[model samples]
Target: MGANATTLHPNVASGGAYDHMKLNNGIKYSFTYELRPGSGSSWGFELPENQIAPTIEETFASLWKFAEEIYADDNATGRK
Candidate 1:
C-alpha cells in the first residue's frame, strides 16, 4: 500500500475496546486504526464512493503485513 503511516499518541485517554482488551486480557498485539481519505482530500468519514475500494484494498494490505510479521515472529520464537 502507498498510504502514509504514522504513530499517533493522543493526550486524552480513550477507553476504547482495544484498551480494555489489552489492559484486562493480556493481549499484547492490539491496534486501533483511523481510516481517512487520502492526503489532500477534504473528506473525513464521508469518503467518496470511488475511494472506498482503494481504501479497503490498502487496509487489507496493511493488515496482511501485520499478520505476516506476527506469524514470522511466532515461528522464530517457537510459539504456537
Candidate 2:
C-alpha cells in the first residue's frame, strides 16, 4: 500500500493504535485501539457519541486478517 493509505489505517500512532477515515459527508474522524498486552489489555476504539463500535471493530479486525492473507505465515503483521 502507498504511504498515505497505510497511514490512514494505523495500528500504532502517537502512542496508540490510531486510525482515521473520511465520511461521505466530508467529515473526518479518528479512532485508536490497543492489541498487545504491554501497557493495557483493552482494544479501545474511540468514536463519536452517535457512532457505533462495530464499524471500527471490523475495520481493525479485517485489516489484520487481510494482512495475514497477503503475507507469509511468519511475517503476517498486516504491515506494509
Candidate 3:
C-alpha cells in the first residue's frame, strides 16, 4: 500500500522497523525492516479501516509496550 493511501501494508500497520506482527489474523504478512545508515528514529502504526481509532489509553499502552521491546532487545544500545 502507498503511504498516501488508507490501506496499509502490515509493516506500516505494525511499526515499520519495530513491526510487532500486529496484522489481522488469518492473513500472511512479511516485510524486511532495516534502518539505513543515515536514518534517524522513526515510528508508525496501523489503525485498520474496520477498527476505530485508538483511545488515548490504548495509544499510551502501545507506546509503552514498544518501548519495553526496545529496552529488552540486546541489539538496542544507548545510555542506560
Candidate 4:
C-alpha cells in the first residue's frame, strides 16, 4: 500500500490483514484491519486506493464482521 493508502490511523498506520475486491462499480478496493495494542475493542482499516472509496454501509458491514470474529476469539480464549 502507498503512503496515503496506509495512513488510516496515526497509530495503526501500517500492516494488517487485508481484504481486497472489485466492486460492481468496477472500483478495486482493499481494507486492512489490525487490533490496537492492549485490552480493548479497537481496530482500524486502511484507506481504499481506488478513485471511489467504499460506502459507509459497506465499511460498517466489513468492520462489524471483523470485530465480531475478534470478539469471538477473545471470548473463546478467555482473554477478555
Candidate 5:
C-alpha cells in the first residue's frame, strides 16, 4: 500500500457513529478510514475508475494485516 497514514480524533460533540460506538456502546475498537484519491490527485472522494482496483487491493491488504496482528496478540495473551 505504502500510503501515508494518520490518526484522527473525531469531535465528541459531533456524535458520529464511531464516537457513539466507542464512547457509549463499550466497543473498544473502532476506526474510520477515508480512502481518497492517491497522492497528488485532487479528486477527493471521487476516486477515478482506473484507481478503484488498486485502492481496494490496498485497503484489503491493510485490513488483513490489522486482523493478523490482533489475532496474534490475542493468542499471545491467551484471550479467547
Candidate 6:
C-alpha cells in the first residue's frame, strides 16, 4: 500500500495517533477520510470527501466510524 492509497489507514488521528491494520486479504476497496485537528476552538470536520459525498461515504463509512473513536467528541466537534 502507498501513502496515499489503502483499504484502511485514513488520517484517523487527531490531536493524537494510532496504528491501522488490515488483515483481510484480496479485499480490494477504495476508502477515503479526512481528519481535521480541532483544538483551535474553531469549526472542524471529519468528512469523507464532500465533493463526492455519496461515493466517499459508501466506501469509507465503516473505517470512518472506527477512526472517530480515537478522537473525543469535543476534539472532533470543534467546540469552543
Output the number of the TM-score-best candidate: 1
Global lDDT of each candidate:
0.71, 0.45, 0.41, 0.49, 0.67, 0.43
TM-score of each: 0.69, 0.27, 0.30, 0.36, 0.64, 0.21
lDDT of 1 by residue, 1-80 (tens): 11112234344444567666766798757786667664567786898899889889989999999999999998999988
Model 4 TM-score on a 0 to 1 scale: 0.36
After TM-score superposition, the amount by which residue 25's alpha carbon in candidate 2 deviates from its true location, in angstroms, is 32
| Every model: Cα RMSD to truth | 5.3, 14.0, 14.9, 16.3, 5.5, 15.3
Error of 3 at 26 (Å): 30
Provide the lDDT at 17 for model 1: 71
Candidate 5 local lDDT, 1-80, one digit each (tens): 21112234233234367656776787746666667564577897887899899889989998898889889987998977
Best by lDDT, which number? 1
- What is the alpha-carbon lDDT of model 3 when measured against the actual structure? 0.41
What is the lDDT, from 0 to 100, of the residue 47 in candidate 2? 45
Ranking by TM-score: 1, 5, 4, 3, 2, 6
* Candidate 6 minimal-lDDT segment of 10 residues: 13-22
TM-score of structure candidate 6: 0.21
- Model with the higher TM-score, candidate 4 or 6: 4
Q: What lDDT is reached at residue 49 by model 4? A: 44
Residue-by-residue lDDT tens digits, candidate 6, 1-80:
33233323346522221212222343223233444432563445543355456655655775676557535554677743
lDDT score, candidate 3, position 27:
25
- Mark the 10 consecutive residues where model 5 has the least summed lDDT: 1-10
**Can you list the residue pairs that collide in candidate 5?**
none
Q: Ranking under lDDT, best-scoring first?
A: 1, 5, 4, 2, 6, 3
Tens-digit lDDT string for candidate 2 (3-76): 33354344644323222233233323333333332354354444444445655676678778766665764356
Q: lDDT, candidate 3, residue 68?
A: 74
Q: Which 10 consecutive positions of candidate 2 have the poorest summed lDDT?
A: 14-23
Instruction: Give stretches of model 3 more than 4 Å off.
Output: 1-54, 75-80
